[model samples]
Target: MSEVVLTGVVKRYGPVTALDGVDLTVPAGALTAVLGPSGCGKTTLLRCLAGFERLDAGAIRVDGREVAGPGRHMPAHRRRIAVVPQEGALFPHLTVAANISYGLDRADRRGDRVDEVLALVGLAGYGDRMPHQLSGGQQQRVAVARALAPRPSLVLLDEPFSALDAGLRAGLRHDVREALRADGATAVLVTHDQGEALSVADRVVVLRSGRVVQSAAPGTLYREPADQWVAGFVGDAVLLPAVASAGAARTPLGTLPIAGPTTDGPVTVLVRPEQLRLAPASGTDAVTATVLRHDFHGHDALVALRLADDTRVTARVWDSTDPVEVGAEVAVRVDGTVRAWPATPVPAPAAAADPRPVHPVA
Candidate 1:
């Protein structure tokens, strides 16, 4: 396993900057996920590391070796970084065994190596099958096995599970994560799927536009996002407008304490619906609102509430909530730590000494 590091890494496509000056470090033996909306720089960042694209600026290093920089750009084959892209891109004519074995060095070809990768990827006996003969999930497994065949120190996966159906995707995703961990491989996965990124990565880097927005453990990111963009991008968030007087924000939901880096007079209060609890209005700090619309998703229900002033807030309830019906009055209370005002940009490793504010997530 190897630690992957990038410093001032950048890439541009004509007028569009595919990647800005991004600096990050993926801990050794850790599965790091790059997450963002479509058109963000997530995939470009991965391509720079994989040597699939040349950078206009900055450096990329794997383990302790420089892979890209001034006069030092290494080619993909020589970098020893394996990539499993979205299409799997398996050779149609090659059987699973041949495809996987294609990566094995002549010296390492012995001792059931072919069987080993297939077994590791849960396609043990399917090696003889051609790519077209296998199911989508099976073919994807072969793709993974083929990448791992080289036993590279670093692996990069770009939306590798998109082809599989929902049920199979979930199972195979977990299996693939486990397999990567078992091999002690350092991996970086790039995807737009929040659940996929959250479920597998040891740490997640949420990107926006062409820069890194926030990189944190999944739970920390979900519980307390660095800004509105990271929070909203990863999952559902309820943003409410508020007026700040002193240190507290006054909403129709009563005056709630808002903590932030800077004091902006009028700003938005960001909170997750799960943090809201319903209670009687008179006795609590809760503000009253009327339920407008609600949706029940299996075990959880999302209720959209409109206050007397017409401001809306969404609250998530487990099961069908008896809190209040449509047009019925109810009190809303904030229970967890949430950003009360505009967010300050987070700093990156490249700017560790510079101390300038990083770009905010848009």
Candidate 2:
């Protein structure tokens, strides 16, 4: 296993800068995921770590050994880092066993290493099958097996499951995670899919505009985002302008407790869909809203609503059987403490129309 460290990393192409003074530490024997939108430098970061691209500035070290720095550049082959590309780029003519044994030395090729890696990826008895004969998911498993056969110090997976179906992708993710854990391999995954990053990786690094925005464990990142932009990007958020005093914020949903300390002033409160509770319109203390739409999933449903003041919000209902019809009057109440930030300046048109504004779903 290897711990990779990067400090002040920067890369540029002509007038455009891809990476900008980024510092990150990937722990040993853990899966770290780099997540961001397109053109956010995720691929550039991975290439720098794999020794494929020269760093314009800063240093990269693996296991306390400088691999890329001033007056020194180690080639990709000598870095002991393996990469699994998007498509399963396996040789069509080579059998499963032969593809895995291609990277091993002549002496190691003749040993049982290929069989060991095949078994590790849950394809023990199908070594003689050709690439065309295997399913897409099976082909990806072979790709992973080949990357692991050489016992690399670090493995980089570039959206390996992006091409598969949803069911297949989920299953393959679990299998690959298990295989990496069993081998005690340190891996880095680069993907734009938020769900994949949140579910599979031990640590998630969020990048935006060539800079690191946030890096934390999945649960912490989701529950406590650094700012309103991050809160909206990670999950469904309802942002409301309100006045905060003491420890509560007064909003369209009535008074909601704040998660942490805040000065007495205008604030923007973040309420997750799951935190809002709905019931039949009843008591005077509850805020009433008309259901605009109901989207039902197997496990839960997202109910869109418009308040008496024409502010829209969404609530997640866990009870799938109790259907919420459109145009139904429902009483809304907050279930828990919410995150709050200092209020941002509203746009001129939006501020002129309403003194208190509610942002749409993000």
Candidate 3:
């Protein structure tokens, strides 16, 4: 296993900067995923780590040995790193055994190492098969086996499952993750898929515009995102404008509990759809809302609602719940801790507006 560390890493192309002052650490034996949209520097970061791209500034180190920095840059071949690209990149003319053994020394190649790696990647007894004979998923597994045959300290997967169909990608990614774990190989995966990163990685690093935005465990990143941008990107969030005073924020949904260091002023509260509940608008804490629409998605439903104040909110309900129809009046209940931030400035409200009863949904 190897620990990767990048300090003040910067990469540029002419006037365009792909990575700007990025600092990150990947723990030994743990799978870390670099997640971001396209052109967000995730791929460039991977290339720099693999020694394929040189850094304009900062340093890159693997297992405490400096690989890229001022006056020091190691070639890709000497880094002892293995890479699996989007496609399997297997030689059509070579058999699985020959491809895997290509990385082994002549003496090692003659041993049972090829068989061992094939079995490790769940491709046992298929060494004699040509690359073209295997399915896409199986071919990728062979690529992984080939990368592991030499037993390098680190492995880099560059969207290895992106090319496969959804169903095939899911199953192949599971097997690939398990294979890497079973062998205790430290891996760095780069992808734009949020589900893939959250499901398979021990740590997720979100980047945007050539900068690291947030780095945390999957659950923490999902539940407690750092800002509005991170919250919106990580999952579904309902943002509402409100005012904070005396430890509570009075939002359109009514006064909700908030825990954060903020002075009295306008704020924006973020509530997840799952945290809202619906029922008859009779309880003192329930606020009246008209069901605007219902989106039934197999296992659950996304019910859109408009409050008496005209603020819209969405709730995710299971199909097992009582059916709700459009234009139906219901009570909305807030069910969990509320996250609030300084609200963006808006124009003043118009005079002579209709007055309506607003109740707490807590």
Candidate 4:
């Protein structure tokens, strides 16, 4: 396995910058996920690491050897890297064993490396079958096995599980992660699925507009996001306007105690849907809201509500409890200390004037 280090990496296409001053480190034998929206620079970063795309500025090193930099550029074939794309990209004319053993030296190919890799990917005895005969998930496993056959120093997976069904994708993800870890292979996975990144990666690197936004463990990124945008992007959140005074923030929901010292002023409080609890309206301390809608999601339901002052919020409740009907008054209370950010007030829309009815005349 190899450690990849990128410093101030920059790549541009004409006037568009696909990667802008990005710095990242993928440790040896660890799977790091690059997560972002569709147009973000994750794919570009992967290609750059694979030596397929040269950097416009900055440096890239693998195992302390400079591969891409000011006057140094290594060809893709020279790098000991393997790539598994969205599709399997197997050769139709060759059998699974032949496809996996394509690039190895004649002597090495004669050994049992193909079967070993196949076993690693959970396809021990399917080497003789053609790619067309295998299922989609099986075909992807073939691709992964082919990449690992040569014992590459690093592996790059570009949304490898995207084309499969949810069940197949989940299974394949688990199998692939295990195969990589068992082989002690360092990997970088580029994906847009938040759950996939959080569940599979040892560390997550979030990118936006060709720039690195945050890099940390999945739990840290989910619980204490760097900002409001990160918080909203990571999970479901309800932002409310609040005022801080004497270590407590007063919002429309209720007066919530703050954890750290802050300047007394207006702030934005972030409360996740799961933190909001619902109960029958009775106590004066609990805030009252009318149910706007209830969306049943098998094990749990999301109850939409509108406060007395017209503020909207959502609460996730267990489906086993009595179902909350639309327009039913319910009491809502926060269960934990909510996160607050610098206030950025959004101007409410101006009230519309009364519309006078005009009769149509012939």
Candidate 5:
């Protein structure tokens, strides 16, 4: 019955507001990843839901029951929830089965339950083995198995695979998400890895400055973000100068008719590296740029271009395509249409507003 929901949830820590106000809904049996940079309150939000931290204001509900509100706060143990922290946090003194079954309070059905969960996590027959005896990835899998032993309605994973190597992390992410789904357990994963969130989450909730930024499916959030901050956080983006008035956005690509209603004024264009291409010469909007720097990342080559205006941009192209070395002349073209987002109107230094392709991420 636990369909997790949070409305206007806020957490304050000694004059510093950790979570401004967060509203989210995790549908039953679905996995949601809370994604954001460090210190963005993703962990704070998860902790509040896990009943480890008290909320200063707002409501938290599980299974249509209000656990945290104006005057009511539920204790962590009574919340019937499980939290698997980053380091696995396994009990050093206990065997793998003992660690997983430590939370079971009702019955002494530990033997069958432990065996079932172990097999479910692909760690069958490792009951007597101590947590320290297992490999890092195996230990993580054991931790997940332990969280599921008690059969909680929801599982809170705080960067559970952050410590594993890249390859192991990827494999564990898939296996863990599948195991959770197979058990019909709702999960909330808190992580800073964009690829991790995009790959395993049924939906992603992004937070910034203690507030919920954007919440949607992985592809939707990546392709069409709610704002510039969301666009940048969910994936890599290039915000170019553009004009939008009435309905259409006059962009370097072409005049694209508007989708949603937009304010009439100057706006910044948002383009992903995948949406740009290097082509033959064209007119004014087709920028004349010199390939400044490039890097080969196996499947794709990241090419940095310095436009005549001195604006630097990074474009991603397949390695199979022709290579463009540094100092080569190239005309960068916008593949399709780009969205025009209103610029943040706040006073700032000129250098702070400088746009360069600083980070090229997958």
Candidate 6:
């Protein structure tokens, strides 16, 4: 196990900067996920850590040893860092056991290390099978096993589950997490998938525009985002204009308790869909809204609503017995405290016509 640290890491491609002063610490024997949209520097950061790309400026330390830094650059093969890439990239001609033993030392390859890692990834007794004989999920398991066979100090998984089907992806994530934990392997996973990052990693680092926006545990990140953009990006958000005072805020849905302390003034309230409760519209104290749509999931349903004031919101309903129908009036209430941020004024429209001439479509 190794604790990886990156300080002021920067990578540039001519005038374009892919990574901008990124400072991160990956704890020993824990999985840390780097999450972001495309072009957000996730891949660039991973490449830097793996020694595939040299840093323009900054330092990388693994287990307190400088691997890439000023006046030093260790090649990828010498870093003892293993990467499990997307598509499982296994050799079709090699059997499951052979592929996993590929990276091991000559003597270790002839030992039980292959079977040990296979069992860790839940692929025991299938060593003789070729890569094509296994399912997609099984192939990914082989990839993970191959990475673990050599007992690397650190592991890097680059969107390892992106190529799998939805059902397979979810199951593979759980299995992979368990495999890494069982082996006590420290890993860094780079993925654009929000759910995968939140569920699989011990900590998630969110990146945007070549910089880290936030880094927190999954629960903390979901329950308390840094700002409105992160709130909307991580999960479903119901943002509303509100007036805050004391410990509560008044929104179109009525007064609701704030998550934490905030200044008294106009604010933008963040109400998660799961925080909204719906009931039959009858009580005068309850705010009423018309159901615009109901999306049914197996275990839960999302009910979209439009308040009398035309404010649209969504509520998550766990009970599927009494389904909410479209166009039906329902009473809406907030179940718990909500997050609030200072209100950002909407930009005013131009008072005069544009100086540039508008071309009429022929």
Please give the distance, in angstroms, between residue 264's alpha carbon in candidate 5 and its true position after superposition.
3.3
The lDDT per prediction is: 0.78, 0.86, 0.84, 0.85, 0.80, 0.87
lDDT (tens digit, per residue) of candidate 5 on 140-161: 9998888888888789898899
Tens digit of per-residue lDDT, candidate 6, span 10-78: 888776788889999999999999987777888888888888888889999999999999889998889
Q: Write the per-residue lDDT of candidate 3 for residues 1-362, one digit (tens) a residue.
A: 88999999998877778888999999988899998777778778888888887899999999999999997899888888888888888878889999888878888898998998888888999999999889999999999988877877788898999999998999888888888888888898988899899999999999877788899999998887777677777767898988999878898888988866666798888899998888876857678999999988778989999999999899998753566989999999888778877876432211211112111000
Q: Write the per-residue lDDT of candidate 4 for residues 1-362, one digit (tens) a residue.
A: 79999999998877778888999999999999999876678778888888887889999999998899997889878887888988888889999999999978888799999999999999999999999999999999999998888888788998999999998899899899999998889999988899899999999998877888899999988877766666777767888889988878999989997654556799887888998998899867679999999988878889999999999999999753678989899999999887777786442221222112211000
How many Å off is the CA of 104 in candidate 4?
1.8
Which is the leading candidate under lDDT? Answer: 6
Residue 182's C-alpha lDDT in candidate 3? 82
Query: TM-score of each candidate?
Result: 0.88, 0.93, 0.89, 0.90, 0.89, 0.93
lDDT for each residue of candidate 2 in 37-92, tens digit (9 for 90 to 100)? 77788888888888877988999999889999887789888888888888878999
Record all residue pairs in model 4 with backbone atoms less than 3 Å apart, i.e. clashing: none
Pairs with steric clashes in candidate 5: none
Q: How accurate is candidate 4 locally (lDDT)?
A: 0.85
RMSD of each: 6.4, 7.7, 10.3, 10.6, 6.2, 8.2
* Residue 336 displacement (Å), model 6: 1.2
Structure candidate 2, residue pairs in collision: none
Q: Show where candidate 3 strays beyond 4 Å.
A: 283-285, 319-323, 344-362
Q: How many clashes in each structure?
A: 1, 0, 0, 0, 0, 0
Candidate 5 local Cα displacement, residue 210, angstroms: 1.4
For candidate 6, the clash count comes to 0
Residue 134, model 1: lDDT of: 81
